[model samples]
Target: MTAINLAKDGLWKNNPALVQLLGLCPLLATSNSFATSLGLGLTTLAVLTLSNFTISLVRGLLDEETRLPVQILVIATFVTLADLSLQYWFFDMHQRIGLFVALIVTNCTLLGRAEAFASKNPIISSTFDGLMMGTGFLLVLLLMGTIREVAGNGTLFTNLHLLTGTPDMSIQLADSGFLLLALPPGAFLTLGCLIACKNVIDGALR
Candidate 1:
């Protein structure tokens, strides 16, 4: 597929979070707040892109049996780097979602892309695909986090300083917000609404 098609598929047509639902564990867990969501999203993006590029570069050397293991090793290496970097640079943020960072190795989105796209494609195409797919996942996390934060906390960007190293950037929207949205049940409800909206939009476009 062309670059444009790849971008479209990753960002919308086949979003890892929204459509493929590949990494919902981290997506839902870290999406309670915007700062946590962005932190995990960016880390996942970096790991995904780098792992794809690395896997594509070495795809020719691997036989069918060892491919999955090698791809996973590449992904794990990147995830470790990301986790350590976050711990060193953004200790507070890392403390919030560091486990999730490590769990990126198990995220199906990374492995699926490595197996389905990167292994079969050229380096440039594979890298771009990873970047786009990661961005799509990040956007979905951001949206989910934004909705949950606003509805549950009555604020946006609460605890954002953990990621930005700046003063608190939260903007309070109300005196109080819905308590349910701050809980696990809220994640499911919000995701359901988002999927429904995407389907409606797609249907309209068609």
Candidate 2:
């Protein structure tokens, strides 16, 4: 596929979180607040890009029987590095979503891209694909976080300083808001609405 097509597919047509429905565990768990969502999103993005590049670099050298195992090891290495970097640099954020950070290894989105795209594509293309896919996932997490945080807590970016070391950027919209949107069931409902919206938009385009 051309670069444009790859970008389009990853960002919109085949988004891992919104469309492909991969990595829902972390996506739903960490998307309760913008700060937490941003933390996990960036970590996942870094690990995805690095692992994809490394896997593509060694694709030709890997045996068919060992490819999956090698890919897991590469992903694990990056996850470990990402985990350490977060703990050292963003200890507060790490404490909030540290468990999910380690769970990036189990995210099928990373492994699926490694096996299906990285293994067959050139390093540059694989890296680009990873970036696009990771960005797509990040965008979804951000949207969900924004929706839930605003609707549930009546605040946006409360504690965003945890991620961006800035003065508090939060804006309180109300004293309080819907309690359901801040909970787990709210995640499912919001995601379903997002999917429906995407489908409607796609249909209109078609």
Candidate 3:
């Protein structure tokens, strides 16, 4: 596929979070705030890109029977490194999302890309695919996080210092917001609305 089509596919047509719905665990569990979602998004992006590139590098030598196990190992390695980096540098944010961070190993999105695209494509194309897919996932996380934070916490980017170590970036709109939106049910509601909106947009575009 051409670069443009590949990008469109990963970002919208085959979005991991919005359309394919591969990583909803983290999406729903850790997306209560923008900071948490952004941290997880970046971590996923880094791991996804590295895993795809690495897997593409070794695809030629692996047998069919060992491919899945080898891909898991590759993805796990990057996830571990990402987890460690967050724990060491962004310790506060790490504390908040550490569980979900570890859960990235089980996220079918990474495995799906590794098996479906990276294992069969050139290194460059695989890398691009990973980047686009990760970006798409990140965008969805940001959207959900933004909605939850604003509706639930009455803040858009509260506690952003946990990720950037900058105090002035936080915003507060109200003393107490709709607390329910910060919970699991809110995640589902927001996501469903997002999916519906996407479908509507798709229909309009068509």
How many clashes would you count in candidate 1?
Answer: 0
Worst 10 residues of 3 by lDDT: 159-168
RMSD of each: 0.7, 0.7, 0.9
> Residue 203 in model 1: shift from native, Å?
0.8
Instruction: Write the residue-wise lDDT of candidate 1 on 1-206 in tens digits.
Output: 99999999999999998899898889888899999999999999999999999999999999999999999999999999998899899999988898899889989999999999999999999999999999999999999999999999899998899888899898999988997987989998899899999999999999
State model 2's lDDT: 0.94
Tens digit per residue, CA lDDT, model 3, 62-134: 9999999999999999999999999889998888899999999998999999999999999999999999999
lDDT of 1 at 51: 96
**Candidate 2: residue 56 Cα off by (Å):** 0.0
TM-score per candidate, chains pooled: 0.98, 0.98, 0.98
> What is the Å distance of residue 144 in model 1 from its true position?
0.3
As for TM-score, the candidate ahead, 1 or 3, is: 1
Regions of model 3 farther than 4 Å from truth: none
